[model samples]
Target: MTETLRARLARVGQSYAPHEHRPLAGYVAAMGAFGALAASLAAAAKVTGKPAPERPSLGDVALLSIATHKLSRLIAKDSVTSPLRAPFTRYTEPAGAAELNEEVRDHHSSLKHGIGELITCPFCLAVWVATGLTGGLVLAPRLTRLAATALTATAVSDFLQMAYDISKHAAEGD
Candidate 1:
């Protein structure tokens, strides 16, 4: 018996990433984890009087988490939707898988758009990294939370707007 298309797509996972390529979901998760760690370190350093090593911040974690969620949704959509589309449906035995294939395709399409929206812009990633650096700098005391606050706010808002734009793109089939 042949394996179903959904099974095949699900197996693809995010593992399809090239050896040199950064897996979007993995990167997003790492960013979130990194941010959480950094924030903990910052709070720790503040309490212990130990010098805070550079790290991510709460805002960073929030952004990273959002990105991770987006990518995860993408993977799920693709895995689920592809099996429902045509050609794949033809492979179904006894009954046609057309409905399944169509559903998969629609969701997969949405996810693909989400992926592009999540990571397509170089500036967003740049700002995200910069925000990390700025968060680290906040430990200096001279740097002040005011500056960090501003940057964090910018990062969050910018990402939110871009995310919205990406959704629009996906909805329009771009």
Candidate 2:
């Protein structure tokens, strides 16, 4: 049944984008997994008798936003975290100070290609990161805030360091 469904999806993908691999089935699978995770998290909260907050605070949202940005970049592009994405992406070059440029590796399996794309794209991964962070905010607010604070601080430090470098370069030019 699964094979039949996959074949049908492949045909649809081919019709939609004859020249490119669309991986519609793979995308569907990824979306299903995300939905499952969210459902399970909700179930867990219910089973544990932990009520989700009525509304998250503005400060918490801001912290998670910054943390999510930092974490998504770290996972998707950081040189140190490349190993996590190595299976799906081919190293191309150094993108920045501690980041890498990579191209998704093509494979016969659309699932692998789909996952590779997700793991290599920071913008794509941010949704997953933000979801997890939001879940954490409900389940463990204190720990979540602590971790978010650290990530936010690191992001600010990176920006400051870049600004300092630019200032030094300008001074040297003068």
Candidate 3:
């Protein structure tokens, strides 16, 4: 996991600026793909009476929740790099969650997030997709619901984190 993140950051160096120009056309194209994917799920759900195969399955609800955790870290990227992250970041080595957040922060800052995280949007989409997919699967009738609940809990945690960010940013704003 650590190696992969570093590799991405290192590899994307020049092209990943916050305001760099990538074609607006490219952005629209990506969103169109995303919308298509989203619509397909709904379409499928209507026919299947099952949850969309979202992004997970009955056997891997836990796995999907793990992705939700990663998404939260991304949202928290700024603080993860802050001095406060030092205490634990040192012990975590390579880069712990805080640093992970830092990387996410760096990503948003470095790249033109446009509407914000077109890349991140896919990830955020995945968590729900996984949940919806798992929900309708045959083996565990309850699994998808559990994943949805877990994802919701994770979202609350993420919200608190964002709220924290808002507070910090607000103070900085002042």
Give the candidate number with the greatest lDDT: 2
TM-score of 3: 0.35
Report the backbone clash tally of model 3. 14
Q: Which regions of candidate 1 are displaced past 4 Å?
A: 1-25, 48-122, 143-174
lDDT of 3 at 59: 41
Query: Of the candidates numbered 1 and 3, which has the greater lDDT value?
Result: 3
lDDT of 3: 0.48
Among these predicted structures, which one has the highest TM-score?
2
Residues 77-115 of candidate 3: C-alpha lDDT, one tens digit per residue: 334334533322222233432443322222232223322
**Please, what are the lDDT tens digits per residue for candidate 2 over residues 27-135?**
8888998898888878888887889888888999899999999999999999999999999899999987799999989888888888998998999999998998888
- Which 10-residue window in model 2 sums to the lowest lDDT? 41-50
| lDDT of residue 145 for candidate 1 | 44
TM-score of each: 0.24, 0.96, 0.35
The superposed Cα distance between candidate 2 and the true structure at residue 113, in angstroms, equals 0.3
